[model samples]
Structures are given as C-alpha cells and as structure tokens.
Target: MTAPAASPALRRPDGSALRVLVVDDEQMLTDLLSMALRMEGWEVRTADSGFDALTVTRDFDPDALVLDIMMPDLDGMAVLQRLR
Candidate 1:
C-alpha cells in the first residue's frame, strides 16, 4: 500500500497559520491538545488557568479557543464572558 497523503495545513484569511489557544487546569490535557493541533500545522498555545488564559488571549489574539469549564481561579464561563 502507498503511504497516506498529508493533510492540508490550516491557514487564516491572510494565509498565516491558524492560531489556537487551549486552556485547561490539567497540564496533561493542555499538552496533548497542543501536540495534536501542532501536528495539524496550527500555531498552538496553552494556559493552565483562567487568569493566565486571559493574559495569553490578549497577547496571542488567537483565532480559536479550546477552554475547559471548571478551573481553580476563574473558570471557563468567566473567561469567555470577560473575553467578549
């Protein structure tokens, strides 16, 4: 059998790599998601807390977000609300 074809890389409207921010209190989960997204050619960043998520969100200006619901400091709902 022939090797599998590579998938197309994700890109933004201006042609830059798609930026994704992953937030989770669990470090393992964040790392796993980051690895998977990076393999797909996305620019991935991870935050371990809601507070840090907000800080990174401001600087990264990510095109997409993967957020966990329950967190120690601020929780996902608050973070999303603040973001809006």
Candidate 2:
C-alpha cells in the first residue's frame, strides 16, 4: 500500500510568529518565494535589490533572511558582511 501523502507545504505548530525576508533580483522568483512563505502563516517581506534588502532588513527586522548569492548592486556576501 502507498504511504500517506505529504502534508501541507508549511507547518506552524507552535503558533509562533515567523518574520522572513526574501531577497532576489528576479522578480518572479521573489514573488513565488514570498507567496509560499506567506502561505505558511508567516510574515513575509521581499526585496528585489541589494539596497532594497538593506532597507527592508532595517525596517522589517526579520528573524530569518533568504538572499540570493549574486545580486545587482549588492550581493549576498556583501550584505552579510555589511550586516556583520
């Protein structure tokens, strides 16, 4: 017999608030990521550029950040460096 199907994409059992920041130069990818994260009942924010990511980090103060390695103006490494 086949095993049970996979559960939902996101699982928030503790009912804790999750703040996420997604940074990518590709608008489509960013939108998709944001949509998926939000579906998990998480607070999601997206930044399409390095500068924007910095700005968002300041204001959004996300608990976690998903950033592309290569981005225009500011790459992920550079951003991480600046944050440090």
Candidate 3:
C-alpha cells in the first residue's frame, strides 16, 4: 500500500522549529505519531480527549494539529468546528 501523505512542513523564516499538537484517544497511535513528529524536529504534545485537546490547543498554540476523526467525548470535526 502507498504511504500516507507527508504532513505539511511547519517552519519559520529564521529556520527555527515548529510546534505540533496531536489529538487522539488511541494512545498507541498518538505515541507513534508523536515520535515521528519529534524526529522531524517539532515540539509535539498530545491529548486524549476533546476537552483536554482544547486545553492543550490553548496552552500550546500549535502551528499545526494532527487530529483523529473518532474519539470519545468529542470528535475531531466537532473540535474543529469549535475552533473555527
């Protein structure tokens, strides 16, 4: 199978690091994705629920979000709507 598309590169004009936030209730997948993001030289954080994610989003102010579609409490779409 083909690999998933690469996540958009988050960079600074000064060539500094990027910040990433990963939200997924699946602990294993979140951990794996966090590892990959860290390898890309990003500061990564994760949250296991929508409530927690919103808190993280506020605190982290991530340059990009890696969100899961299915989650307990609230899903990614709902979270995105609230963000918008």
Candidate order by decreasing TM-score = 1, 3, 2
lDDT tens digits, residues 1-84, model 2? 999997754434566668899999999999998998887788999998888999999998888899899997999989888877
Better of 1 and 3 by TM-score: 1
Q: How far is each candidate from the true structure, as Cα RMSD in Å?
A: 2.2, 3.2, 5.9
Residue lDDT tens for model 1, 1-84: 999998777699999999999999999999999999998889999999999999999999999999999999999999999999
Task: Please report the candidate that would top TM-score against the real structure.
Answer: 1
User: How does each model score on TM-score?
Assistant: 0.89, 0.79, 0.83
Which window of 10 residues has the lowest lDDT sum in candidate 2?
8-17
Q: How far is candidate 1 from the true structure (C-alpha RMSD, Å)?
A: 2.2
The count of backbone overlaps in candidate 1 is 0
Give the residue spans of candidate 3 off by over 4 A.
Answer: 1-10
Local distance difference test, per candidate?
A: 0.95, 0.86, 0.89
Position 76, candidate 3: lDDT: 94
Which stretches in model 1 have alpha-carbon errors above 4 Å? 1-8
Residue 35 of model 1, lDDT score: 98
